[model samples]
Target: MTDTTSVFENSPEAEFGDYVALLKPRVMSLVVFTALTGLLVAPVSVHPLVGFAAILFIALGGGASGALNMWWDADIDRIMRRTRNRPIPAGKVSEGEALGFGLALSGISVVMLGLAANWFAGAFLAFTIFFYVVVYTMWLKRSTPQNIVIGGAAGAFPPMIGWAVATGGISVESVLMFMLIFMWTPPHFWALALFMKSDYAEADVPMLTVTHGRKATRTHILVYTLLLAPFALALAATSIGGPVYLAASLVLNAMFIAGALRIRRRDEAAAEADGYRVEKRFFGFSLSYLFLHFVALLAEAGLAQFGWGGW
Candidate 1:
């Protein structure tokens, strides 16, 4: 079947699962995990129900962003092999339906967050959705190689919003958490770009690899990985930091740096010979790198609850 045939299939009506897929549940999981870590690691304690409600609303806000992003990027999604199976591109859901679903959830989440927690957190959620949908998806994704760099802020805001839910304001610790994700994003995405360069090129997305070439992208990956290590280490020095986080940071950053260096050392011929194995491996490792760092933070929080965790 032709690509158009696949995309325009007169398939059965979209099932509930198709709508769930539009929310990008995998990405939402990361948002939920990081946001939960933010809430749990805060210095102040919230009532259990209030804390649960805050996280739920924050998660809905995250889901809404994903839906809107998919809706906006549907054209490019249809072009890119990896994204071709998404609800919109697969003809499982219409773009208009996705847009409406996203906006409804966005309003519900923000307003409920305000009533359930505080307007500060609510406003932050609103802005997170806006940044992801309007700023990154609509503008930067098509405009520049630095799209990931500037757009990374939207993904990094979840922890800050979660913190606001607990404390009603931002703090050094919250910003540190944001920085951790921000710095890690370039290397993480660049690694993927190294392998998925063709996808970005075909979609006219202007990813670093497509615009600046692979060697520069590799160099950039190493540079950002180096820069990310210090941020991770510095977070371990904050009020949120402790022995657990420090030890985890040291190990994870060391492994991450090694991966980046491996990718940086290889030429395109070598990468082709190995089927971009090193780049793909590093891309896989990058996911675990961010996840483990926050897991360590969560462990620190657990220890602090028993009075064992502190600087």
Candidate 2:
């Protein structure tokens, strides 16, 4: 359970923007994009209005997860430089307000998603919220070095939920989409951990970098990036894949592997001398790596309309 004691004095009032910030809109945007991609790439077609509502509810669920996370982590958020300004830690919103807001959004998002799409997708979204807030945030984050490895599942679920919204069930394609994010996550976050340096350590978050050492983390990034390649390329052989996706995956995977290798070979002295330029570049490229792969998937979906996409 989260320590409910106030970490900061409550602000007089939380503005509308403060409320939005509590939602972690930047993270929510990624959720919306990936979930939207899942919906678009699925074999089934949904009414635009229905699809729109489903995506909205899913985004709400993601936001709810963020709120609850902030509420729970308020104590540590106050300590972490990267997170010190979050609504809860900064005193813009009270913990009670964040909790109540999160609960409200969670309920609404789940119930409305069930109504707008299928009950399966709704239940999945509910489970996702639970996994993120309870399982990941409350359980794994502070306890284990593998937190991000497992917690990554919470972020990975959006695309699957989007696929479920359209198909009313799961499939190889959806699972592949899920795996793509799941595999991509460790390296992506480990890179951030690499650059963020002491933030996680000061917070006592037990991130892989802190627990296993930077060398191990770098090696893990390379191994995961290598493992990610097979899954990415395999997706190109699926019904959703096409020439565009295959071409994109090939180039992206090559570059991603190269980036990982660069990180793996560098020592702390070299990194410090260069101000961690290589790691920072790797982190920035990681964002494009995932985005371009998804965009390639979307491109394949679009091309299919013209009879040029898919196996």
Candidate 3:
């Protein structure tokens, strides 16, 4: 007989490292970098210490969202090969402890950001956390295959929030940054979904592949990739982008689009037989695509400081 009684009693007590793992630190790195880019590119200048504080608080908010997500998704995560080993699902942390930790950090991050930066940035950070945890994790995740598509907006908010920290307001540039990430999310995530469809199927999650089949998912990836190219290029037309950003966008999008096309051309059997190697490569390249784009934007900003590039 399965021992179903008082599992918590035997479960290891949650530790500091487990709590940290709940935060998904690697994902938080991208959040910090993109937010810093937005802050740097904004026309307004902030004190270095204040800018640092704002980015730190934004990162904490990202971590809070990640923890909350892990807490909520622990069930499906345990069933899925990709997420089976996360802290909560793998028995490293109790769900209750994760929930409490996430909630506390969410509150602390918002209040600290307001005190250290501005209320506008703080409020946006708060909303970002709420949207990710409540709107995305609680509402959208289990309900629809469009989960990542809509949930991506939460991830897209960091750069805008950082821009708000510097300018104390929103603008086209910040919105463009948000749009870039927003458009990038579908293709990026769908590629992984293509390669790992079995995991989602086993977890009973309504990922695109689970709800719509690999062929349909591949088509959707291609469609989103096509849509994303313009946004990637459009960023280069913004005040933030210049020679550096344009060059990066051109090269990255060319490769990304080509990869998507290749995926579209491959039959499911061929893809699976090869362990979806192309999809995996595309997924890895997509990570570089985003980071390189942001780095290019930063380089342009740096160049403009020396009167080298800008509108």
Candidate 4:
């Protein structure tokens, strides 16, 4: 069938699942988890119901951003294998509907967050949605290889927003949470780019792998991995970290660095011929890497509650 044919069949009303797909549920889950970590670890406290509301709004904002992103990137997404089946690209949702849904949800999330939590949290949520949709998807993705590196700021805002919901503002502690995700985005995305080089090349996108070649991408991975280590440790040094964080950081960082080093050692042909097992393994591990770090932070928060451990 033609692309137009596919697009029409994929509208939100066409299938129950298409609507959920538009929200980018996987991304929302990560946002919820990280934001919860931020709320739980913050020095201040929020009522249980209010905390739940804040996280709910944050999740809604994240979904809004994803819908907007899907609306904007529908054309290229249709062409790329990795995103070809997304609700918009597959014809389950029209661009206009996605845009309207996203705009409405964005406003609702921000206003509701303000009423349920604090204005600071609400403002931060608005900014995150704007940055992700306008800054990252519209402006950055196709403009430069540094897109994920810099645009990562959009994704990194969740935990900070969560912290603000509790603490009513930013702090060194909250900023450290932001830094961990910011540093993590590059290697995480670049690994996917390495294996999906052909998808980028087909779309004429300037991913680091496409622009600089896989060899250079591998080198870049190692460099970013090196940079990631210090930031991870620095988070441990902040008020967020404790014995649990220290131990988690040490092991996760060691495995992450070792994965990058392995990628650096493999030639492009070797890496690809093995179906990018190394890159894929690293990508898989990176997911665990982020989750473990946040869980470690949660552990630290629990420990501090008992006066047993804290930064």
For candidate 4, what is the total of clashing residue pairs?
5
Q: Write down the lDDT of every candidate, Cα atoms only.
A: 0.92, 0.94, 0.90, 0.91
Please provide, for model 3 over 201-280, each residue's C-alpha lDDT reduced to its tens digit, 9 standing for 90 to 100: 88777899888888998999899999999988998888888878898899999999999999999989999799999999
Which residue runs does candidate 1 get wrong by more than 4 Å? Answer: 1-12
- Name the runs in model 4 displaced over 4 angstroms: 1-12
Q: Model 2, range 1-311, lDDT digits (tens) per residue?
A: 13433433433478899999989999999999999999999999999999999999999999999999999999999999999999988877999999999999999999999999999999999999999999999999999999998999999999999999999999988899899999999999999999898999999999999999999999999999999999998999999998899999999999999999999999989998998899999989989999999999999999899988887
Which residue pairs of candidate 2 clash? none
Q: Give one digit per residue, the lDDT tens place, for model 4 in 1-311.
A: 69978876653554667877888999999999999999999989889999999999999999999999999999899899999999887777889989998999999999999999999899999999989998989998999999989899998999999999999999998888898999999999999988877899898778998888889888999999999888888888888887789889999999999999999999977975888999999999999999999999999999888897675
Worst 10 residues of 3 by lDDT: 1-10
Location of the lowest summed lDDT over 10 successive residues in candidate 2: 1-10
TM of each candidate vs. truth? 0.95, 0.96, 0.94, 0.95
Error of 3 at 232 (Å): 1.3
Q: How far off is residue 186 in model 3, in Å?
A: 0.9
Candidate 3 displacement at residue 224 in angstroms:
0.5
RMSD (CA, Å), candidate 3 to true, equals: 3.3
- Sort all candidates by lDDT, best to worst: 2, 1, 4, 3
In angstroms, give how far residue 19 of model 4 lies from its true place.
1.8
